[model samples]
Target chain A: MFKIAVEMLMHDKTKFLGLLIGVAFTAFLVTFAMGYFAGFMTRGFALVSENSSAKVWVMDPAVSSAEATINMSDSSLDSVRGVAGVEYATPLYLGDVTARYANGHFQSFQTIGVDDATLSGSPQPANLLHIPNSVIIDSGGTEGKLQTPLSKKDVWSYDGSHLQAPTRELRYGDVMLINSKRVVVAGVSHTIPRFPPRPLLYTTTSNFKRLIAGEKRYITFIMVRPVKNITPKELAKRISQKTHLKAITSDDFKKETVMWFMINSEDVGDMVNMVVLAMLVGFGVTGVMLYMFTYENLKQYAVLKAMGASAKQLGDMIFTQVFISAVVGSGIGIGIASLLAQIISSPTFPFRMMWFAPLIGFFGVIIVSMTAAFISLRPIKNMEPAIVFKL
Target chain B: MSKIIASCKDIIKTFNSGEAEVKALQGITLDVYENELLMLVGPSGCGKTTFVSVLSGLLSFNSGVCKLMGENISAMNDDELTTFRGKNIGFVFQAFNLLPSLSAIENVALPLTVASRKRAEILTLASEMLEAVGLSGKEDVKPSGLSGGEQQKVAIARALVHNPKFIICDEPTSSLDHKSGEIVMELLQKIIKEKGASMIVVTHDNRIYKYADRIVHMEDGKIIKVAS
Candidate 1:
């Protein structure tokens, strides 16, 4: 019976293609839309990487996934340093720093100042972060970076004019512009580099203390890293009580970043709408095409019945055919969609797809195909074998 | 002679539509013996097809008891009747109505699939039956690709694959030319003898009548003559 169903689909490659392409496109749209949703939810807290090494992040007392970032007591830094198993503690002042672009325009930025330490500074700027002019930006961060180090004398110009920047074989002396406070490309790291406020810039704690025009000098976020004996959560709880501040470990901080992203904007809704539309298109086209297929095969069903085939057997045949279509179509569809998602991973859409979405899509298309098969079943389920005998 | 496999004892069938009524069969009595090849001939609108349908448990008469394999046809419910028909009876249609989507072998295996037994066994049996019907190596070919004679052979193969006790054929070769019709008739006669299954065929083609062991002639739903 399965062989027969396979033969039926194989005999009409054009019809199967139509069904497959239709289903594949629908799946692509749904998965790509999911990528956007995931991207949006994670972007809001790009600070997770920035504040990562800080095992204990001490935030404002009113801190939550849905609240505005506030100031922490400057005195809380020493108390955190004295905490048990406390190797390094820093009064990480995260603030909005506006960079005057070459075009004489200032863009708001997320800036942080960490006391020059080894094990407990931000991962994005652990080394040379204390330098006067050095920073890390996503390869695809501002201008969407290329992850390879390209060598051309013309590539490393005075200004940001290198199509393929000679990011290698250059020292802080050759790459740095200490006069204008610029951290030139001394090394090109091939990673999903972190950026703050959609773009990033790094400078020394001294420069940050002097450059931040505000007189209050109260830190926005306090950071600490656990030594050999201390756990991150315990440190955070101690900070929370001592400073009357909200404390989150790196893991909790990551969740907060994701949570803030999810509930803070309409981006999630857009992604949801996109998936809803894909499913809608999937179901709609599946209904029309599968219905036509059912209509085309109705006479064949009648003939089978006339030959002593039972109604249940006939139904199973129809279901088997549709089920095969669904499996093949959805499999090809998801495979193509995954390849596409990988090809388009950039600043425009940042997402790490879970196994769940594709798995769900696979099962989802099968159910949809079954429903589509059943949608066209009005004639088949109610097929009258007596008619063929009449003729 | 063996006992009757099917007996239509004074079967009566009527059709009533609102204010008008039509009687297709009245007071028809016949006993179909085991392994007998019976040809029922009648003009259009005669009760030849209806009688075969009732005997196959595919139809029910308005009055009278039609016993098939000793089970009263009228007394069985729809599911029970279907079961009895599927297990004990086979049919060959005039149109050679094989499912276009299924290959010749798959069509032949359909009855066993409907009975929901082991599928691989049914496929093997269906292949052998098709081979017996003179359609060797055409098992994987769909009905559309088959010749008229080949399609008819597939229908016959489907009928006999289930190993039924009785085969009900409605104009088995009505659509075929004289040569093709004779081939189909010969196959049916050969299977009836070998399988010990009785058959009642309805056809106007007398060129193939030599294959019938008994011929029952009718016109306007009334039996005019019976010859052996």
Candidate 2:
């Protein structure tokens, strides 16, 4: 009977292919959407990830996320270091700045400043200190909007109007202007791309103050390392109590950042909508196709019933058909999604196939297949075996 | 006296159409004996098909005492009836009712499979039955590849594969030509004689009347005459 079920489903090549393709498409769409969402959330809290050595973060009470920060006064860093459980503490500065290329092409960038002595959160501390007036730019920024024109001929005209053409990739020794001061690109740092993708520049706290000029309260956060005996959560609690400021472990900070984006960003909402729509489409197409397949072969089922096949045998046959479709379809779909993810993902377009992406797709296919089987079973369950004589 | 293989007494089946009640079988009472070929001849819309369905336990009646192989089928639960039917009854249909996806041997093996026989034994028995039905070299051939006569032979092979005590055939020759119908009836008569099994064949075709040991005529929902 199980053999009969397989033969019946496979014998109709056209319908079998249609059902497989439908399930595959659903799995692919759901997996890709979920991977994209996971990648986006990961990058949303990239700052917390980069400073993984720091166990606790101290910030102004109102600052909820790393991307949107309120600057703390200079006294905050000293105050955090004074806490009993804090072993080491360093200041971090974050601000947005516009840089003008040598050819006068301007682009906005997110500037990050680590403590001058420790360079606590700098992606490339050695490179920052290797050159004078230097900053390390993220690799993604170098490939995208921050690419510098090769020469005046690349962008300039006599009338001061520029025609943009072939630009050179930003690399070592490239010069850009921040606040009317010259800053050299000392090195390229490969960092996780941020949401809303702004170019990144990393420098020392002293260099940042010198370049931007006249910002009295510049420290955005104070990164702290807890003592060997103290956990980060315990240290954070002590700091928050002692300083009257917001203090959280790095993991908690990352979570807070992701929550902020989930609440505030439309992109997350849009991705969730896409996932739901994919599931619905998967359910609709697979359900209709399975129901139609069963309906067309109803005479065969009636024949089996009249031939003394029990209701349980008939149910097993239907389930066998659905199980094959789901397993094979999900396999093909996840395979395609993995290939597509590899081909399309880049620093600029973030996509990571987290372990759960395939899990989501597989369970999603199962749910769709089971629902289809249930719908197709209704007609078979109620069909009278005597109808075989009539047909 | 030949053993009574099946008996039906005061069987009544009805259907609901909109607000009206349609009587499909009205008080059908009959006995089928071993080693006999019983044919139910009737016009269209008569109760022959419905009567056989009740006797085979493929259907339920509004009221009746239907027994097959000495068990009261109307009193049995669905599971018990299904098990009883699988073990005791065989069927051949007007349309042949062969599953198009399976080959000749698989179709013949369906009864044994339903009986939960071992796979090795099932294949050997199904192969032997197909060969006995004159489909020896065509065991792997699907029904679509076979002619009407050959398909009917396969259906007959399937009907006897499990050695059921009784066989129910619904218009088994209606879809075949004159020569094919003669061949089918001859084959059925020969097989029933060899196996010593009783059979109830429902048909409107008069061409196969010579093959029956007993002929029962029905009209409008009742048996009007029985000739033996």
Candidate 3:
């Protein structure tokens, strides 16, 4: 009987292909939406996620997340370090700075200032990030080439009107002006981009203070490490209670960042809306296609009924057809989505295909297919075997 | 004399369209005996199809006693009727209504498959039945690829493959030419006689009248005459 159902579907090749395409598109939309949402969530907390060495973050009492925080007084770092269950604390400088390339192209960049001595909170290797007047640019942030004087030994000279160096290293030796002060690119740091889409750069806290003259005595956050036996949550509690400042564990800070993004960012809300709309469109296409296919085969169902097939048998046949289509369609859809994910492999694009996303699409297709089967099998249930004789 | 395999006592069926009511079968009373080929002949819109439908338990009559193999069909619920019909009655349609997706053997094996029979057993029996119907080389051919005569032969094989005690064929030869119709009628008679099974065939093709043991004439939803 299941063979009969499969054979019937195969006999109508045009309709069968139409059904597969419908299901495949539905799967593609569903999986793509899920993957996009996942990528957005990861991007929303990139700052907290990349600073993995910090167990707790101390900031102004009014701050909600790492991205939307007021710069706390530099004295707060000493207060945080003095609290029990806190091993050490370092000032973290975070702000935006505009950089003018030697080529006259200017771009806005998000800058993170790590402790000069400890190199804590830096997104790159300590040796590369701790160098004076040196900065690390995010790989995905720059638009085009950043030309600089060719230099290898970090020495500079002038030849008439041109800047001269002993070596020619294009991206590594790039020189740019930050706040009208010359800065050299030490290396490129491959890191995830945060929201607002600004290029990210990392430098020493001393250099950050030097670049921004008026913002000398303030810091955005104090990165703290808990004692050997104490957890981040316990240390955060102690710090918050002692210093009267907001102290969030790294994990909690990640959640806070994502929550702040969802509540504050219009782009996050728009991505969620897009996901819902994709689901609606997928469900609609699958439902209508399955219903129309079953309706077209109603006469054959009547013939089967007239041949002494019970309603259960007929119903089972319809279910078998829908189930096969759903499974096959999901497979093709996921395959296509994965291929797309691979092709659009640019780090700048927020597209990440999680392993569980395809499972969500699979279950969604099953539900839609089952709904279609139930609705389409209604005519078979009420069919009279005598109808075939009249036909 | 043969014992009666099916009997209809004053069976009545009516079709309602809004306030208009049409009687399709008006108190049809008939008896089909064992091992005999009874042909019900009538013009279009007569009660011939309706009577056979009721007798085969495919349709419900308003007020009548319809029995097959000594069991009252009206007493059985829809499910029971379906199982009873599947086990005891076989049907042939005017259009040679074989499933286009299936080959001839698979079409013939439908009844057994519906009964939850094993695939191996069903295929063997279906192949034998197709061979018995003189379609030995056409077992693997789909109905779409076969001619009208071959398709009709496949339908007949399907009807008899289950070894039902009674068979009802509605205009079984109407879609075939004279030579094909004669061949099909002869095949049906030979198979039914060999199995000692009774058959009631509804058709307007008078060329195959010689194949019937008794011919029943109907008009305006009522039986008019009987000839032997």
Candidate 4:
């Protein structure tokens, strides 16, 4: 029966291709929308994802996601560090600053302040922290606004000695003004793109205070590591009791951030709308094409029915075709989507093809295809096998 | 008991099209006995096709006693009728009605496939039947790839492949040339006689009338004459 279904579909090359294309386009839209949404989710939790070593995060209760910058008293770090199950606690300073590059291009950046002694939360190695006025930049910014300028070939020159050489590019010793204070690029960090779509800059806590004045002690978050015997949830509970601040485990914090972004960000709403629109388009095309295909092959169905094929057998044949179309279309659609994701993938683009996203989309396509197949089966159900003689 | 494979007495079937009642088969009384080839000849819209449709258990008559192999067909539900039809009867159509997607052997093997026969055995049987119908080398060709005559031969093979007790061909040679028509009729007759199966062939081709064991002529939804 499945063989018959395939042969019937293949008998008319034009109709067969039309069905495939319809299903494929629907699959592509659904999968790509899911991938794009997943990408936004990844960026929304970039801070939490990057600091995966931290067991718990202590923040101002009002601060939700990486996009929300709520400053807490710097002394809150010591309170977390003093908890009985706490192994270590470090303050992470997050602030925004504008920097004018050597090309005189000024852009806003997410400046991260690392613990001076341990260089925790810093993109640079501990050894690189010794260089006074040193800073680390994200590679995502170097391609343009958010990428590291040190890696640009036309900008920097390699001198034979340790002394600074004449170069147009930002390098190990080049100075840039952040709030009238000069800072040097000592190292570079490669980081995934973030929600703000801004380049990342890392500096010591002292540098952060100097760059953004008006406060001597400001901490955005306290990254904590718990003792071996203590689970993150237990340690977070203790920290919250001691410091009167929100101390959430990594997983909870990730969920909190993603949820906050989903609720607060207008772009997220737009993205969700786009995903729904894509699904509607795919559903429309697939449903219409399958209905037309079944109607065109109604005579063939009549012949089968007249030849004593039971309703269940005929229904099974229709379902088999729909299932095959879904599987084939999803494979092709996912393949095309992955290719497109790869082609347009960049710091500025939000397209993340997660493994589970395509799996979910596959199921969605199956449901849509099956619904269409059922709609097409209605005419066959009512058809009297006697009509075969009329033809 | 007489060797009656199928019998219908005073069957009534009507079609209500847009408020106008049309009698397609008005009190049709007929019988097809075992091992006999019954040819029905009639002009267009004279109820020849409708009569066979009812006989094959496809169309339900409003009132009548229709029986096949000692079973009351009209009393059976749709599912039972379907099972009985699959096991006891076969059909061939005027247009060959070969599923355009399937090859010659696949079309011939459909009834057995529906019967849930083993694939290897059904294929072998289908091939043998196709060869018997003068389509030896054309087993793999689709209906579109075959000539009008070869397609009809595949249809004939399909009808006889299930080894049913009864076969019905509705104008099997209507679309073929005289030579092809004769070839089809001869094959049908030889196969029916060899298998000892009853056949009801509805056709208007006068050239093949001699091949029938008996001829029934119909007009305006009723049989008017019978010749043997």
Candidate 5:
């Protein structure tokens, strides 16, 4: 009977293909949207992820996430250093600065100023103390918007048109101006990409102040390492109580950052809407197609019923057909999505494939197919076997 | 006396249309004997089909007893009746009702498959039955590939594949030409004689009445006469 069901379903190639495509399209869109969402959430806390050695972060009470911050007075850093269970504390500066390339092209960059002595918040190769007035650029940006023009001639054509330049990546000894102050690219650091992609510059706190005019002498966050015997959670509690500021463990801070973005960002809402719409379309198309397929084959089902096929047998046959469609359609859809993810993934585009993406797609397709089968079961259940004589 | 293969006594069946009640079968009583080809001939809407459906347990009756192979069909639940039918009753329909997706042998194998017979045994039996119906080389051909006569032969093969005690054929020759109809009746008669099984054929075609061992005439949902 199951074999018969499969043969009947496959006999009409066009309808079978249509059903598969509907399911596959749904799976692909749902998976892609979910992967994009997961990617954004991961990149949301990239700053905290990079400075993993910092157990606790101290910021102003109004600061909700690492992306958005309020400046804290220099006394806060000193006060954090003096607190018990705090092994050492370093002041970190986070602000936006505009960099002018040699061709006079200006681009905005997010600047991170680690401590001059310890380089606490820097990415790998924290030897910034060896180089003076030099900054490290993120590798992601060096290949992207931060690439340097070879010469002024490359900025314009012979007709005086504003033609784009054929540029090269920023490398060591590349010079750029920040607030009229000259800075050399000391090294390129490979770091996780940020949410709203921006060129990154890592410099010492003193250099940051010189590069940005009229910048007050304040820090964005205090990165603290808890003493060996004390947990970061306990240390954060002590620091928060002592300074009357918001001090949280790095993990908690990452979750808080993601939550804040989920609530405040329209991008997340838009992605969620896309996922929901995809699921609805999947349900509607699959349901209608299965219903039509079953309706057209009701005569055959009646014949089987009159031939002494039990109701349970008929139900199993329908379920077998739906299960096959769901499993195969999901496989094809997720396979295509994985291939697309591989082809288009980049630092600028947030598309990370979490394990749950495929899982959600597979189970989501199953639910849709099963629901369709259930809906199609009604006519078969109410069918009179004696209709075989009439037809 | 020949063994009584099936019996129907004082059976009543009705249908409820909007604002009207249609009595399709009213007080139909008949007995089917082994090794006999019984034909129920009547005009359209005369309830011959309804009577056979009730006797075969494919339908329910409002009152009275219908038994097949000495088991009370009306006393059985739906599942029990279905199993009983699968094991004891065979059917050949006017349309030949072969699942278009399946080949000739597969269609012939349906009854045994419904009985959950072993796969190898089912194939062997289905193959033998198809060969017996003179569809030997056409085993793999779907119904669409066969002529009307060949398709009915396949339907007949399917009906007898499980060796049921009784066969119920409803207008088995209505869709065929006159020659094909004669051939189908001859095949059905030969097969029933060979197996010594009882049969109840409901048909309106008077041309094939000569093949029945006993003909039961029906009119207005009642059996009016029995002739041999």
Candidate 6:
């Protein structure tokens, strides 16, 4: 029966090709979307992921997203660092500040205040550890400009909030003049994202305290890394119990980040997957068309039935045909999806396609394929043996 | 008393196509004695085909007492009818009804395969039957590659493979040439004589009627004569 099943598919190559393309394309779609979603999702927590060196993030209970934060007293820092499972709690100060450049073009940048005690403390390419007056920015700087002079513009404008401006392009050792304070652009990095814009400024935690110019809270968030096999959840539970703030694991933060993106903003993860889903739906529609290829040939199925084939055997014929289409089409679809994903690769994209995505995609193809095959079988199942003798 | 292989009384079949009901068969009666060759002969639209289909357990009659080898066919459920048909009746169709994807021997061995026998065993049995049908050398060729007569011969081989008590041939030679048709008729006569199984052949081709030991004629739906 299997050999016959194989023969039925082989004997009709054109129909099989249609189904294969349909199934493979469907597989590619689902796989690509899931992969990108995974990849981009990981990036949403880049600040934490790049710095998961910290085991837990300490934030106010009302904080729903990474950007939505309230400060706890720097005094609470002592209690967090002193928790039983906690080896050390690094102080982090985060807030958005528009860095106005000398070029007159202003860009919104996030200022994270940290010292040598944390993971993001060390600047890549050039070290800013010794520069108490310096700040670090990503990949060149605003307008692909990096290693330029850093000078802060006016702070405490008419609104009484500290929104300082600096030079747009920052190269190493560049100095920036800010509101009543002088910040030297000591280090430049690439691809690390902050909340507001392309240019990120990292400075000493102490300087971050004095430069802010407003009544401050604790830290934007705390980054902690467990010493051993201690699960992040257990540690977070303990920390949450000890403090009045919420302590969340990095993975939980990642999920929250993705959910926040979905709810409040247009995340690249959702966009990429939405495109993939559209393609998969196209493949399903195409699969329905491919089924017509088999449906048109249903008279042949009736002939098989009249030849002493049981319902199972007849159904198997349709199954084998559908399976062939799924294997080929899914192969094509995933292959196309993967190739497309690779074609559009960048640090900002967070495009990640994995194997399981395609595996699940195959199930998708099989489901639609089987549905196509089964629906096609309706006409054949309704076939009457009485017609075999008809004129 | 000879074995009463099959009997039907007061059989009715109606088909609801659209808003109107088409009555194909009404009040038809039939009987086949053991080892007797019963032929259903009539013009077109005479319900000859419908009569055989219902008697073969492929169609359900609205009202009837239809029995195959004394088992009530009308009362049998679908699966029961299937099992009954598989055990007791074999069919031969005019268009040769061989699966095109399967080789000639595979076509002959289909009944055995449907019964869930091992391929090797069924193939061996099928080969023996093909040889019996004068098709000893053409076992591996599919139905499409064979001649009309050869295809019909394969169908005949399939019927006899199960050693059933009754054989149903529905226009088995209608699509064959005169020589091929004669060969099929002769083969059927020979097989019935050898196995002592009753058969009912529904056909309008009077040339094949000589092989029938008993002939029943029908028109519109009712049987007009039973000539012995």
> Best-fitting candidate, measured by TM-score?
2
Assess the local accuracy of residue A308 in candidate 1 as a C-alpha lDDT between 0 and 100.
53
Count clashing residue pairs per candidate: 3, 0, 0, 5, 0, 42
TM-score of chain B of each: 0.96, 0.98, 0.98, 0.97, 0.98, 0.97
lDDT of 4 by residue, B2-115 (tens): 499989999889999999999988888888889989999989999999899888888888998999988999999888988898888989899888888888999999999888
DockQ (Cα-based) per candidate?
0.28, 0.63, 0.59, 0.58, 0.56, 0.29
Q: Candidate 1 chain B: minimum summed lDDT over ten consecutive residues — where?
A: B51-60
Model 4 lDDT tens row, A1-391:
8788877777787877778888888888888999889887888888888888888999998887777878888778777888899888898999888986643446677888888888888764655756888788774433545323433342323432222223333456666678877788887677777874667888888888888999755899999999999999999998999889999998999888889878999988888888898899888888888878888888888888777789899889888888888889888888899899999987668678988778877888888889988998899888778888876
TM-score of each: 0.73, 0.87, 0.84, 0.85, 0.81, 0.83
When summed lDDT is taken over every stretch of 10 residues in candidate 4 chain A, the lowest stretch is A156-165
Candidate 5 residue lDDT tens string, A1-391: 8899899888878889988888788788778877888888888888998888999999999998988887988889989998999999999998888887765577888999989888888876778534888999884323467777766565423544332666777888888888888898988887988876667899988888778657565699999999999999999999999999889999999989988887888876776787788778876787677778888899898878777788888899899988898888889999998999999998767888989998998888888789889988899988767777776
Evaluate residue A27 in candidate 1 and report its C-alpha lDDT on the 0 to 100 scale. 62
Q: Best to worst by lDDT, what's the order?
A: 2, 5, 3, 4, 6, 1
Q: Per-residue lDDT for B107 in model 2? A: 93
- Tens digits of per-residue lDDT, candidate 3, A312-334, equal 99889889999988989888998
Q: On a 0 to 100 scale, what is the lDDT of residue B119 in model 3?
A: 87
True contacts kept of 4: 0.66
Higher TM-score: candidate 2 or 6? Answer: 2
Cα lDDT tens digits for candidate 2, B1-228: 989999989889998899999898889899999999999998998988988888888888999798888899999987788788888888999999999889999999998887779999999999999988889999999999999999999999999998988999999999999999998999999998999899999998899999999999998788899998
Question: Per-residue lDDT for B20-112 in model 6, tens only?
Answer: 997888888777899999999999988888898888887777998998888898887655666677778888987777777678988888778
RMSD of each: 6.9, 3.7, 5.1, 5.6, 4.9, 5.4
